[model samples]
Target: MPAAPLSILHVVRQFLPNRGGLEDFVANLAREQARLGHRVRVLTLDRLFSAPEMRLPARETLEGIDIERIPFFGSHRYPVAPSVFRHLGDADLVHVHAIDFFFDAFALARPIHRRPMVATTHGGFFHTNAHSRLKKLWFDGPTRMSVRAYEAIVACSDSDARLFQAIAPGTITVIQNGVDLDKFAGAAAPEPRRALLTIGRFARNKRLDRLLATMQALNAEGPDWRLRIVGVPSDITAAALTAEIDRMGLSGAVTLHTGLDAPAVRALIGQSSLFVSASEYEGFGIALIEALSAGLVPVAHPNDAFAWLKERHPLITLADFADADAAAGAIRGAYDRLARGEVTRGEDLSDYRWSGVAARYIAVYKAALAEAGHGVAATAA
Candidate 1:
């Protein structure tokens, strides 16, 4: 006799229409969970942080997963959406994405919902150095207290594992993020060019200015390398980025892009030689995975997450983007190696496949359910 399917509920601050690693992670995991014969539903805020003025439908279904959006009140830093309680009726397991309000709220309401809960720490709130003292207090106090409610904590990177492990010992399981390989698979040029690509939110920590400065230094050395920055606006506006480009005398070599469909972005990736990022922090480097999938070499800042990635894949090179000359030299080194055909493009990311990642999460879900005394099958049925 077959076991009954599990009903999984994903509680995230944002979803699909807002593009990012966390959104992609939830979307892929939910889709894979649904595909594996489990019922999956996503509950997110109605507003997109990048496009606050826009409103999404209250409820909808996509890729076989039901999605429900609740209105949030506080700032994006910690949007409060207690209305999620009304939607948890049929869920056997509640999987929270990131360590924000939902993580804490659902933890407090666990007794009411009577559902097992697990959380994926998508690089937590310390991305930037804004208010370090208070952030530490909140993490050591509220976050430490809140995480106790979770049956398991899925850390996306080794760096994240270290952080969460300190507060919640023996609770973390590191599962790296997955890439939508179909989006840019084999989209790179046959012969790499002297162009670069960077994609993500135009947040302050992305350090786009440092990338532009690196481009300036690289150009001064010779080859006339070009840069294409593609992303949506967040804390940093497009106007500000454009001004920085003009100010650095890179108006000619650097290009700024805000909105582009997948095809358009893929086209830019095809035209570019390599993908690069100067982000000061990342919970996990999703862009690097996407770049490797697209057959492009990645030059990134040696943040804890990127450093962790570098150890896994040799084609990924770490550079100090803060020092323009040094970063430029590293980029040149990558170009030389690519030209020599010494390093090939692409990494067999079977381990990062959504099916595998979803399986890992499913184990956590089953453990959580069993811990709560739910007589559910622990198998991946």
Candidate 2:
């Protein structure tokens, strides 16, 4: 007989239609769990500032997963929803994303639920200066404490796992993030165009300003490629980016896009010759996987998250992000090789499909339940 489906609850700072890797990861994982005949629900903050134009119902179902948005009352983007604890009692297992901010509350509430709990630390801490030393000091204790509360901690990459191991030490599982292979793979041959592409949130950590500088250098050297930056830009970053483009006289060579759906994004990638990432860090490079699946040559900074990918496929160009001259040269060399048919797209990533990812999560969920001595719940007929 087939095993019973479990009740899985995911707690995160935010969810779709907030466009970020974490949001997308939770949405896809929840949807996949629901599709696998499990009772899946998402608990998240109800905030409008991020994507005000895309109004979402406070309580609704999407792609078969139940979503509940709790109004946040705290100032530092930390959510304070007492009702979240009340809802926790209904779940067979709870999976929290990220160790900072809102999830500290979830950790405190986990003992009351007495359900098997898992936490996926999406990235490392101590890499950014945006969080003041005092803020980091204040949250650091809770973050470590919360991580220790989990029965299992999922890390998206080796680097992410190492960071968590430094504090919580055990129960770390390295599960790299998955991409939708069908949505990205087997595109019609990319049309010849002097175009470069990068897709991510326009946050300071993404280091897009460095990418802009590289584009400026490349244009000056005569390759004359247009860079398409596809992401929602912050007001401050948008103003800065526009100013830099104008100051560098790259007005005609760069374009910004926001609010693109999946198909639109894939279409854009299919037309571009290269995909670039200048992120200071990543737990896993989902955008890089998407680029490889779409058969676009990828160039990125030498970050540890891409170490596994680089090992598996040696052709991915890694450059020193601190040196624009060197980074631009690497990108130009890759592009010229592509034009000359000397280099090809990276390896196939069909193994990272959502079906396989969901299966891995299900195994972890079953293990968590077994460890807690709870029988898996039956699936609805």
Which candidate has the top score in lDDT? 1
lDDT (Cα, 0-100) at 213 in candidate 2: 86
Model 1 RMSD vs true structure: 1.7
Candidate 1 lDDT (Cα, whole model)?
0.86
lDDT string, candidate 2, 85-176, tens digits: 76664788889887655467666866666778888888845435576686566546767777766778889888888877866777788887
Per-candidate TM-scores read 0.96, 0.91
Error of 1 at 125 (Å): 1.2
The local distance difference test score of model 2 is 0.76
Off by over 4 Å in 1: 221-223
Error of 2 at 321 (Å): 2.5
* CA lDDT, candidate 2, residue 293: 80
